[model samples]
Target: MLVLILGGITFSHAQTKSDSLAIRQAALDYIESQHQPDSAQMARCLHPRLVKRTFWKYPRQQREYLRESHADEMVLLAASYNIKGDKFPPNPRKEVILLDVSSNTASVKLYADEWIDYMHLVKLNNEWKIVNVLWQFKDANRHQ
Candidate 1:
């Protein structure tokens, strides 16, 4: 009986990790998609009402960047990221998912040698979209 109980607990934890991975994967895909030149390419994974709140390395706090419609916001974010895009086009997304997930929300900890990054995601219209990205970017190298 004890063995069975322990197995169940382990299974639950694994399930949580798996779900969190999915949420985090969505966020990563969105970031990579930003590499594309056009906002339309980035729109696939982003929520129409994605609220972009960034954290600067100096003063640690969530600050309002922009909150707008899908098309407008995507353009703004892509431009800010400095994604010159490519002559080709966006291909199938490539990203890694490592995060903690819950029913309505998720927090993804993007691991890197330099600084830490935490992406907060929310379930909107039954789809996972990154609502907030809080990170202390160490260098100019893009986190994606």
Candidate 2:
């Protein structure tokens, strides 16, 4: 019985590690897909119902407004956001920090050159997909 318990623990640890790695990969894919402007790659990691939200203050606007981007819009943006290849720095910031993971859900924080995104992912059909994100520019005055 003790041996069996230990084996179960070992298996659980391995599974957790695997999940963490997959989750990190999904987050990285989201970031790199944008930088690389690979819409297909971006579509692969995002769920069909993905929702990305941000709070933005338009120029000369007194209040902040909520902005949203869906999966289709994101994929389209990815295809053109960096078409010229000069949008980001030579070595732009792309940091993915795994916040938490469970059996089928995970949360991550991705730091990019211009903004930071808090992302939520879900495991579906044995694949991790980004389902939600809340992002903001690092510098409040900078507008996207």
Candidate 3:
């Protein structure tokens, strides 16, 4: 019985690690699909009910504003570059950090060249999808 319990614990740990890796991959796919203008991959990584919000700073006016975007809009934006035949830089500076994970829910932070995004994800039907995002531009003068 003791051996069986130990085996179960080990299996549980392995499952958690596997889930974490899948979550990370989902987050990476979200970012890469957008950067690459790959609509299919973007759709795969994003939930149908995704809501993305961004805080924009108007330095000239010394004010900030909130902007909201839905999943459809995001997919359209991701594909916009493709429509225009625009090319992105070969190597863009980006980072994805897994913040937390609990069962079917997770949070991740993505640092891109111009902005930082906090993404909320959920495991749906055995697939991880980004459900929400809160982002802001990287301000050099801002204090941490």
Candidate 4:
């Protein structure tokens, strides 16, 4: 009985570690895809209905507004945003922090070159997909 219990605990611990790795990978994929300007890679980690939101104020506008970007737009951005390779500083930052993970759901905080994104991911069909992201400019004054 003791051996069986230990084996079960070991299996559970390994499964949790596996989930953590996958969650972290999904977050990395989301950021690196854009850094690499690979639309296909960006598309892979995003759910079809992914919704990315931000709070922003246009120069000509008076009040801050809620801005949203869908998966299609994100994919297009990944394709063109960094094509010139000058969009970001040399040796840009790309950090992924796995905030939490529970069975089929996970949350991540991604620190990218120009912004920070809080992402929510879900496991579907045995794969992790980013479903939502709330982001803001790293330097509040910088808007791209």
Better of 1 and 4 by TM-score: 4
Go through the candidates in order and give each one's C-alpha lDDT: 0.55, 0.88, 0.79, 0.86
* Candidate 1 off by > 4 Å: 1-21, 55-71, 79-97, 111-116, 139-144
lDDT of 3 by residue, 95-129 (tens): 88888777788889998777788999998888889
Scanning candidate 3 in windows of ten residues, the lowest lDDT window is 6-15
Give the candidate order by descending lDDT: 2, 4, 3, 1
Report the C-alpha lDDT of model 1 over 17-117, residue by residue, as the tens digit: 55565576676565554555445546655665665544333223433343223435765666555454442234533334555566777777664334445
TM-score of each: 0.51, 0.86, 0.76, 0.84
What does candidate 4's lDDT look like per residue over 1-144, in tens digits?
998888776222223777888888888888877777999999889999999998877777656788899999999998998898878787878889888777788889999877899999999998899999999887977653
- Give the poorly placed runs of model 3, Cα more than 4 Å off: 1-15, 57-63, 82-88, 140-144
Candidate 4 — worst ten consecutive residues by lDDT sum? 7-16
- Itemize residue pairs with steric clashes in candidate 2: none
Candidates 1 and 2 compared: the better one by TM-score is: 2
lDDT of 2 by residue, 20-106 (tens): 888988888898887889999899999999999998776665677889999999999989999999989999898999877778888
